[model samples]
Target: MSRSPKINTVNEAATKYQAAPNEEYQLVEQAHRGVPAGAFFDILGFSGLTKEELSGLLDVSFKTIQRYQNDGKKLNALNSEQLLKMITLYQKAEDVFGDLVSFNRWLRKPAIGLGNQHPLKYMQTPGGIDLIMDELRRIEFGALA
Candidate 1:
């Protein structure tokens, strides 16, 4: 693995928010009234996570998610935070893998470093996001086994 300062910089920026678990949510609340729901659609397509899985991650019913999509409504703070996390992770994955196809493939594949869980399976929680991000950091620094 070849490290890039840019990736490390992004990794550090992402890690800084780990302490304030609600910082992302708060930022959403403070920065914008809400995030456009279509952004969710875009991220879902990018992340390769199922709609149900993403709804679960946002703690929203699938039907509500559909409503947001159909109505073009803005997502609540919680959902915005969740979506932001997904987007950030997706961007980092793209940076690491050099393309969406490769990143999506890696996301679906089991990894020894992640205790045999596919990275996509870990997107439901903040800690799980951290695990994936940390794994990315390791790979970035050539620290992987």
Candidate 2:
């Protein structure tokens, strides 16, 4: 007998990935408390993103991100905020694409809605995240790309 793939809901994604303590609603508290460096390993490893991408997204140096990972330090408020946004965006992407692999592939592709730019090129900043989320919403609603 064949079995269906297990669905990963947003809450499940958050819990499974340790993306945040209770998803987006609790972000203010989580941001103040800060995210652990290891969370990025979990987040980025599955997403196939490198530390270079993480550093750019967080506006930190690659070495600093490595230092945090080595030291098990909590991310600063700025990075914590960005990390939460990333988690939210990824979870939504997973939902829209119905799988992690498809979403990751889409992230690496050039999108017409994104002006034919590779999504990753713009995804390193907050505005880029918002733009991607808007595109995802459009896709989810069956809008043209």
Candidate 3:
């Protein structure tokens, strides 16, 4: 009489019970902890705004905008109104651009680099930074005026 093949139930159970841990899971989790500029660009692109157009709308220097994109500056400094406006503008841009990959690439590379002088550099203004801070607070708290 031929004997049936021996089944190693314990070995099978041990193999089944072993949990495969993903080493990169923690790194991926940490990477998403904060909003990076790439995410902002993605949002903006998805909404549909060109880098130049956005820079103009924000009243910030193009170089400054580039810095924000390259450095991953936090959006916490923007007011809710500004954020809303940005959202709207980005949506509009999306309608016009239609391709997110191209839009992101363009955002990373402005028409001009950081050497260009901004129009606002010559303006003598007081409390501008303070106003910006206030607006940022409003944006963060969802209290735009």
Return the top candidate by lDDT: 2
Model 2 gets an lDDT of 0.72
Runs in model 2 lying further than 4 Å from the true structure: 1-13, 16-25
Candidate 2 clashes: the total is 0
Candidate 3 stretches greater than 4 Å from native: 1-40, 79-81, 88-145
Which lDDT tens digits does candidate 2 get at residues 1-145? 2222332345544664356523555775676788777666556655667777777777788778768778778898767766777778887887799877888789888999999998777776756877888989899999986
What are the per-model C-alpha RMSD values against the true structure?
Answer: 9.3, 7.0, 20.6
Task: Please say which candidate is ahead in TM-score: 2 or 3.
Answer: 2
Clashes of each: 0, 0, 9
Better of 1 and 3 by TM-score: 1
Write down the TM-score of every candidate.
0.67, 0.75, 0.29
In TM-score terms, candidate 1 sits at 0.67
16-120: candidate 1 lDDT, tens digit per residue: 323133365664553256666655555554465677877887778889877776777778765666666666676667677777677778878897789988987
lDDT tens digits, residue span 1-145, model 3: 2322332322221122221122234322432343233333433434344556555555666676557657656333332224333333333333344544443444444222222323122111213322333333443455632
- Judge candidate 1 at residue 94 and give its lDDT: 69
Error of 1 at 16 (Å): 22
Candidates by lDDT, descending order: 2, 1, 3
The per-residue C-alpha lDDT of model 1 at residue 111 equals: 78
Best by TM-score: 2
User: How high is the CA lDDT of each candidate model?
Assistant: 0.64, 0.72, 0.36
